[model samples]
Target: MSRRSRPRGAATAAAERRASSRALPQLELGRPTSRYGRWRAATLVLVYVLMGIHIAHWRIRGRTLAPLELNEVMYTLELGVVTAGFLFMATVCIATLLFGRFFCGWACHILALEDLCAWLLKKIRVRPKPVRSRLLLLVPPLAMFYMFLWPQVLRMLEGRPLPTLHLRSDEQGWASFQTTDFWRNLPGPGIAILTFAICGFAIVYVLGSRSFCTYVCPYGSVFRGLDRLSPGRIIAVGDCTACGACTAVCPSHVVVHEELQRYGTVVNPACLKDLECVAACPTGVVRYGVGRPPLLRGWAAWKPIRRPFDFTWGEEVWLALVTLGVLLAFRGLYDAAPFLMTLGLGVIVAYLGLCVLRTAYQRDVRIGPGWLRRAGRVTRFGVAAYAFAAAFVVFWGHSGYIRYHEFAGHRAAAEAVALAERALRAPGGETGGEPHDPGAVPGLPDPTSPTASSGDPMDEPNIVNRSASRAISHLEQCARWGLLRPPRLSDTLRRLYTLRAEARVALSDLRGAIADLERVLRLDPGAAGVHYNLGVLCATSGRDEDAVRHYSHAAALNPTDPDVFNNLGFVHLRRRAWGDAERSLRRALELQPSHALAHFNLARVLAASGRPADAARHLAAAEQLDPRLAQPADPAATP
Candidate 1:
């Protein structure tokens, strides 16, 4: 007989086995226990909450935190970028790293609702052991058949337009409706409800336990790769005792026990830390630990219960069916709020109907384990409730385009005006242009005032400052007339400027008009029409600060005219200066207020300073008054 080779460690192994049998050893899987059962619940709620906040930021809903397109900037967070941007791509990457498809588990609101749908559906699908039998097994395949045949079933979107859904939300045909901009401008409460009902159903049945992860999802492969470095992993130990509890609970269908022979101990990427294996390990061998191989993490090492995945098949079938319905039916309904609401109501009623069917089935059949059946029924029922919740949450994709959804900004005329304004203000000031009479241009309306009170008529300040006056005048003119689709401001300026003179003389109390005319003058002094308008406005309004700027601008821009110089003198005379008043009145007589009456006023100023003889001479000559200057001699030097 061949001598049997005995391993050197046999004696020690036997002794250790005997010692192990004497007392149950304390084993630990993970240092901490994180139950996965509640994770799905928490995750489902978070997505809906996030959706709700997004909807509140719309303009049509009667709120506006900012409007960047007005050419009127309130402020900017950055020199060229808006704030509140989303990091969707980044979140996808993070989800890839943990548990392989956790976004489906954690962030996907649809999936959360689906979990409930599965439970409810199970109640309806309830019966004996048909899940693996021909009766129950056909559901998964039959579902695939229906989904593939009618690819348009995924119509349950939060806010697709009615036209897109092939329903007439408005007068337009479906194609025409799509051509319109319903997607970008609208939101309603109905879409939210629809999303909840359909997505809820998908999570309840079909794929069963990690259904989205196993079939339909392409992202699963990506996640599978990333979870290779998951801090928690599943492993098989020599002490496993050949028990099979881990396989029963696994939602993802990863063979947890097979790792013993394949990988030195056992660690496949399939483990999701669901903790079923730890409880099922009768000898407490299968465990989770950090670093090195053969370490598992979850609740198993410290407790009991065969850890089978809460996996079921209601999920995939449901997703396939609901996604199909939403994609098709939910399309064009978004345009009208009422239509969307009606469609949402229809979906809610349908969900209830399905719920009734499922409940009857569950009560009749004793097919699955108590927990699974309950989960199936409960999950499916959640579909309707979730729809209502989501309807409230999405508000019809209201926040989808927020934070930087601006279209390409290339409107030519607006650009030109903005560019010109930007160029002149950076210190050097003037953008020189050859002279041209705008009044001669065709199609250009003769400028007029919106109100009687317009431009300044007071102040004889340095109007002769040629360069500054010319530059400012040109810009002002451009601002009033250059921008296409000009806002109401230009016309209003013209109105005030047109009536400036009367505004000054009558104490018209049109002080605001004079102020506006002054701003226009600052922007464009060479604008004779505006200057003419301003001088008239100020002389009447008694807005002296403004009156001076406009009068001087008009006087300088059209200096060849004696009427302007004469007007200038009268304004100075009104301020009660003696010699200066005389000089201005003299220039007016020389340039010509021709007997425009400024000289008559000037004599008063000179006389106030005690030039009695000069005052008497002018007073006697002015008795031949133009008569038109009678009613409002502007009593005293209020200027």
Candidate 2:
């Protein structure tokens, strides 16, 4: 009976070998054509064009389209409002639920940038190997929570009221095409370029093309979760020989062959639905279609192929703790560094720390050579590591120094603006007084004169000029240090110029004020407020033609602003264009019925046009709105 059983087993083994040999030939498959590559490129181009259009519309028409950032939505959610960004994110989430991360595969701008990096790496014949670790996967979810959920949760815990749900349309939309303000929205060019290199290119060069998507992007976590319940999936049909061709071409490192063999579908969330696997399959068995839910297969569906470097549960726990701790430790550095740079720095530090601990542990255990040899090896490694770390520290310190100067400059500029505002509101003392020394303290009354209590309408003591000088000094220092170019700090420079202009106006330096205002206009060409200010300055200097042009521009940019219309009418009245003045004054009154200045200005225009009855009615309305208009003009207040 034993002989019969042995013979039967040998016969069955022989039959299995024969069947396997006959079923599929050992065909060595080459690289498959990237069928979706063109589609991805097209989609990326289209998205970019749309973004450009959005920026153009904002710059040209002074209106906002929807924002394109998922982080914007997260920010709005924290504020408990549904902005255009939120609506856009909702649309993406719904589409992901239906089609399974198609945006990540085809439309993401960052993904396109990363893919371009990958293509360049391929040109240099450098193919990166993927580091597969389940522990690393936790980062995206943690980041998602940190960015989108934690702020609101903390607010709730602090007993803060949930903000009302509303769209945030107050500011010009998220991204700008205006070169000056556009750079302000991003990290400084230096830091931005570094981020693209380290997070996008360097990461992909070392840890594979999809490494950032897999381990860092918070938005990817949302899409990954939605993809699990998606109906669209790649399923196996017909003859599948378990050939590894499909797996070889997967940029995301998905075990396509094993997944197909086990569950007859690609159930891995990392599968980007790139369709390279389907194109690479020799048997033509893999195709995208509706399939049974992978979850129905239970535990068997998730059995993963373990690699040699796969982390044990203990190691995973340790790594996770270390990563979280490092992330918290470096949170304050985010303003100095871009988000991706911060994440990459945290990862590097955590990895290095873990390496040190691991080396020490191995040394203590005598895992390799004798104590002396191990100690020598460790010393060599420590020296190399220390050198790299020291260089990194120096670079970090330099960056911190730059950020410090930027902060100091911004603070000084803010103080200058506050001082200027106070000087503007302060009561003017005696007119035709000697100019105070530039070094004298502002907001102080002159001690030598009996009429010192009466403030100068033109700030004749030079208080605003002194404050603006201090601001200009700080701004110049910032510019010298190259801190003024950062988008975050550009507005400070603009404010500095504006403060300088106001100071010039108070000093009766009309030409200098005009030059400063022109600089401000160049920096923000679409600023309606700046246009209005320029119009006022031009009018004060008797440049009636320039004032008319500037006021017309201000009105066009902000048609709803009654001040703009009123100012435009005032400029027209100075030019003695009765028709234009009357029309603009009526429009201003239409916008705001209680505008006394508009009523008085209209009365003057009506009187100039020989309409005594109309002029009398408007004069009465002006007097009722503001009785001060009925009083005789004070000689001291005249510019």
TM-scores for every predicted model: 0.30, 0.55
Candidate 1 Cα deviation (angstroms), residue 337: 16
Writing each residue's lDDT as its tens digit, candidate 2 over 430-538 gives 2112211111112222233353323454553366566556656655654565423655455776777777765665555668777877877877899887777777667
Provide the lDDT at 338 for model 1. 25
Name model 2 segments beyond 4 Å from true. Answer: 1-32, 52-66, 171-190, 295-336, 348-386, 394-639
CA lDDT for candidate 1? 0.40
lDDT of 1 at 205: 43
lDDT of 1 at 302: 18
lDDT (C-alpha, whole model) for all candidates: 0.40, 0.65
Best by lDDT: 2
- Worst lDDT window (10 residues) for model 1? 431-440
What are the C-alpha RMSDs, in order, of all predicted structures?
Answer: 22.7, 14.9
